[model samples]
Target: MTIRFDGQVALVTGAGAGLGRAYALDLAARGAKVVVNDLGGDPHGQGENRAAAQKVVDEIKAAGGEGVPNFDSVSSYDGGFNMVKTAIDTYGRLDVVICNAGILRDVAFHNMSEEDWDKVFAVHLKGSFTVLRAAWPVFRQQSYGRVMLTTSSSGIWGQFGQANYGAAKTGMLGLMNVLKQEGVKYNTMVNTVAPVAGTRLTASVMPQEMVDKLKPEFVSPAVVYMVSNECSTSGYVIEAGAGNFSRASMVKGPGAQPGMAANLDAEWVQANWDRICSLEGAVPMWRAGQTLAAFQAANAKQA
Candidate 1:
């Protein structure tokens, strides 16, 4: 079956180039009225221009797709509100939002400055919050919405010299997880995408050949599906790039139960270290309170 967004509106931040551009183009081609938002800032989040975003809008227009340029920084609350307002005012409704705006401040943990760390959060983490919060009420009233947050491998599994960026990226998952539960009844799905595309953000870190292969085009397909009505799952982290797609998750180990032991201490944990850390029967919890069952089951089995 063909996936189409006909009559729906979408907002893609950082749509001036790379992954965001790919997403906006793809969505527009598939019949969505797209809002191509770009701060047009440098990799370090300095400076801005309206040309980059307008160029993408021009491309969409040339291709006979509907799109409008939105030059706004996602780092502030007002910017976020205006971005969504632009969609609603022009298209009358917004069904999707791809939070792809971010900045890079790569430095070792010891050398990373407070300004660098805070700025990274301002764009990647808080930016997601700002935009999503602006659209939350609309989704609730309409009872339908799709939200895609851009995460990274550095945040999921960690990487060298990206302490600040990694921290901000990983923090998005926490927000996604909570929103998934809250949005369930309203049919608002929240998901994360950890892309390994060769955007300007990765140009410096990756080899030429590898970067050439991992174009943003390859990653945009999975992202489009994530925001489309075709997707049924939520609270999932999908890793995509170079025509490969996979699901990533957080799991809990079935640890040894400390049942009825009133005097448990660090020594007991030390004694059962192997059993506590074993992944043999580890499983992913579907929700926040589900982990308590592991203790109950272990105690019951022990009894």
Candidate 2:
């Protein structure tokens, strides 16, 4: 295959099943040594099973692919470090990491408890972060690495009974954003995907017909490409599922900005509310300095 991994090693979190399993198999089939990590937890982030990870590893080996099983949780720093350590100890180095481990605790904001909130955040947001922290050093030393964070439409848009889930999932985007920024210099790139499929997590909400249409393999392309050498994108949130792929972006529109000497009061905000939310022209992705420059340009003539 032209898209061969050759001698590379890929670490896939939650690889016991679902999209992570798909990714692990695909990479291994393409010649990568895979590290399959799974805490073997329930959809609510409870329980464990060494067999979940072991089974996937066995399958990879049976298919002529090299892989190791890891049962460490990603929510804690030590666990994340141990997972990475396993890859390094077994294969010498890592070329990719798909932080796809997650749990769902669906509840309205009013009814969501602190435990639910913390658990979701622990597995999806901080979990991804902890893994990256472990992998960053190895990536920098090698000067190459691919990272993909799993997000969701519920997190991207909105959904009832997903206050905890949405908050945690969306935070992955923020983590990817900063990782993208920091990784630019070190060549350790990071990106995100909001996937839809018939995983154990989504089997209840998504209809079976739709699930059949949106196979986990269809979502694998986005992950494979993003975590491959060919993909140069970072700080991006792409959506893929059911054989359709699209991108998500943060956009900024030119808004009504009063000059330096102009009043900065509720009246000003009230009057310019329309301008504030307008989207007539295409919006641009503005960086921190760019926003400052826009501010200066807007008030330049006034000064």
Candidate 3:
């Protein structure tokens, strides 16, 4: 079946360019009224240009879709509130939120300043919180909502010289885990996207030829579907780009328990270190309690 948004409204942060622009355009094309929000900052989160946002809104309108421009920084609580307010005021209600705004401060951990860390977190981690927190009430009130948060490979796995960015990106997973549970009863779904796309954020690090191959548009399909009513799964992490899509998840190994002895020591752990770190019998954990449950089950078996 073809997925569409019809009467739904969506708010896309950082809609001025790149992946955010691609997502906003696609969502609008699919019949959703979109709020194209962009602080219009440079790739490093500096400066502003109101036209950056208006241009996308214009594109949406030119395509015969409904949209409005919002020049608000997602890092600010008030900015996030106003972004949601613009959607509600213009389209009446919001059904989707795509937290795609971000800035880069790539530096080695030793060289990374507190300012760099704070700024990155403010835009990525705190920015996500600000917007989602504002939209949370509406989702609960309406009993239906869809959310897509942007994560990165740097955060999901690891990359040298990106401690701040990685930390902030990984934080999205934690947020998704809790929000998924809270929104389940309300019919709200929250999922994350770790997009491997060639955008402004990666232009400096990636080769020009590779950038041309990994278009931002290639990642939008998965993101759009994740935020559509047709998608019921929540708390999922999808990696998409260059027409490739895959699911990433947190898994736990069948850990060595070292018996029920109260005085389990470093020696016991050392003896079973390989077993403790082995992934031979690892299982994907869907919830936090599952890890503990697995441990209890293993203890019972030992008894």
Candidate 4:
């Protein structure tokens, strides 16, 4: 079946360049009315202008797609509200938001400044939350919405010179998880994507061999599905790159227990550390409820 977003509106932050630009264009081409937003900042989050995102909007309109350009930064409450305001003012309603805005302020752990830490979080972590805080009520009223969070492998796996960026990305893993639980009440969906391509944020670190393999277009299809009403998932993180896609996930190990008559003790925990930390026979689960049920079942066996 064709995945079409006809009559839908999407706001994509950081849409001026890189992965954000690619996602904005893809949505517009597939019948979405897009809001292309960018602050026109440097890689370090230091500036603002309009040409970058505006150009993308012009391109979409030229191709017969509907779109508008917004130069608001996603790093503040006012800006987040305004971004949503633009979609409502122009397109009448919003169906999706791709929180893809981010910046790099690389420094050693000891040298990281308050400015560096705050700006990085402002764009990547708090930025995503601010937009959602502004949009959640509207989504609730409409009874439908989609949120796509931009996370990174660097954060998931850890990297040097990225303490600030990594912390923000990892925060999204938890942010989206909680959002998923909340979204279930209103039929909203939220998911994270760790993309790998030769985008501006990735160019220096990506080698030619890897670049040749990870096209943004290849990853777009998966994104389209996740943001569409067709997807039956939330609180999930999917890693896409180099023609390989996998779900990077968290797991609760099958832990050990002393007899039901005995209280849990440090000595018991030490003895069962292997099972508590074991990844062998690990199963992929999506929510806390599932883990709770599994734990209860394991406890019942002892009882």
Candidate 5:
């Protein structure tokens, strides 16, 4: 079946160029009224160029799709509110939000400055909060919404000189985990995308040929699907890029239950370290309470 947005409205932050621009254009092309938002900042989040967002909006219009340009920084609360307002004012409703706005400050942890950490968190982590906090109410009241947050491989795994960026990206998972539960009752589905596309943020690190192959557009299809009405699952972490897609998740090992003993001590933990850390019979944990349940079930089986 064809996935179409039809009368729905979507807001894509950092839509000036790269992934955000690709998302906005794709959503608009599929019949969504898109709000193209870009701070117009450089890769490091400096300076501004309003033309960046307007150009994408122009493309949407040129292709007979509806779109409006927004020049707000996602780091600001007012900027987030205004972006949502733009969609409601122009399209009368908002059905999707793709929090793709991000900035990077790569430096070794020891050499990282407070500003480096703060700026990256402000754009990638807090920026997501600002927009979602603004749009959350609308989603609940309407009882329908699809939210897509951007994560990264650097964040999920380790990366050199990207402590700040990686930490902020990993934080997206926690946010989605909580929002998924809260929004479930309202039919508001939230998911994260860890994309490996070559964008402005990565252009400096990769060769031109590799960048050409890892086009941002290749990652958009999975993202658009996750935020569409057809997607039934929520709180998932999907990795996509270069025509590959996969799910990433948190799993727990079959842990040692030495702590259940009355004389549980550090010595016991030390002796059972290998068992505690073993991945044998590991299971995916969908919620916090599952840990306790898994432990209890293991104990019952042993008894």
Candidate 6:
């Protein structure tokens, strides 16, 4: 079956370039009305230009697809609200949202300043929240919506000199987890992508050979599929780039229990350390309830 968005409206933050641009363009090509939003800031999240957004809109029009340019910063509430307003005012409804706007501030944990941490969080984490919150009501009223939050390998597995960026990216996963539950009844699915695309953000850090292979376009397909009507599963994290796609999750091992007795101490935990950390029988948790249930089951076995 062909996945198309004939009457759908989509908003792609940071659409001026990279993954966001690819997503916006592809959505338009598939018959969706797209809102191309970009503050045109540098990699560190400074400065802005209206032309960046206008260019993408022009490209969409040239390809016989409908699109509008929005020059709103996703870092603030007002900016996020206005971007969604632009979509509703132009297309009359919104069906999808791609929270791809972000900034990078790389620094060692010891040297990272308060400003560095705050700025990264503002763009990646708070920005996603701002836009999603603004669109929550519309999604609820329409009884349908698809949201894609951008995560990163640095956030999931960790990376040196990227403490701030990693923390914000991981926080997005937490937000997605909650939204998935809240939106399930409304047919609003929330998912995440930990993309390894060769964009301005990664140009300096990644090796040239790897960068050549991991184009921004390679990452957009996963984004497109995740937000399409064909996909219904939520609370999923997909890693995509260079024609490679895979799912990632947090899993738990079969941990050792200290029992329900009062005399249990740190020594007991130390003695059973290997069992606590063993990967055997590890499983990905579907929800918070599973963790508690697993603990209880383990205790029952001990009893």
lDDT for each residue of candidate 2 in 131-238, tens digit (9 for 90 to 100): 889999999999898999999998889799998888788888778777887888888879898988878888888887876666799889888888888888887888
- Segments in model 2 whose C-alpha atoms lie over 4 Å from true places: 284-286
Per-residue alpha-carbon lDDT of candidate 5 for residues 1-303, written as tens digits (9 for 90 to 100): 399999999999999999999999899999999999998988999998999999999999999999999999999999999999999999899999999998888999999999999999999999999999999999999999999999999878869999999999999999999999899899999999999888878898999888888999999999999999999899999999999999988888877674354478789778889998999888766678877787788777767
* Candidate lDDT values, in order: 0.93, 0.88, 0.93, 0.87, 0.92, 0.92
Give the winner by lDDT: 3
Q: Report the CA-based lDDT of candidate 4 relative to the real structure.
A: 0.87
Candidate 1 displacement at residue 71 in angstroms: 0.8
What is the C-alpha lDDT profile of model 6 across 3-97, one tens digit per residue? 89999999999999988999999999999999999999899988988988999999999999999999989988999999999999999999999
Listed in order, each prediction's TM-score against the native is 0.96, 0.96, 0.96, 0.92, 0.96, 0.95
How accurate locally is residue 39 in candidate 6, as Cα lDDT from 0 to 100?
A: 96
lDDT of 3 by residue, 74-178 (tens): 989999999999999999999999999999999998899999999999999999999999999999999999999999998899899999999999999999999
How many pairs in model 2 have backbone atoms within 3 A of each other, for residues 3 or more apart or on separate chains, i.e. clashes?
0
- By lDDT rank, best first, the candidates go 3, 1, 5, 6, 2, 4
Model 5 weakest lDDT span, ten residues long = 254-263
- Angstrom error of the Cα, residue 29, model 2: value is 1.1
TM-score of decoy 2: 0.96
Point out the higher-scoring one by lDDT: 4 or 6: 6
- Model 5 residue 239 lDDT? 94
Better structure of 3 and 4 per lDDT: 3
Off by over 4 Å in 4: 207-213, 263-265, 285-301
Tell me model 1's lDDT, rounded to 2 decimals.
0.93
Error of 6 at 226 (Å): 0.4
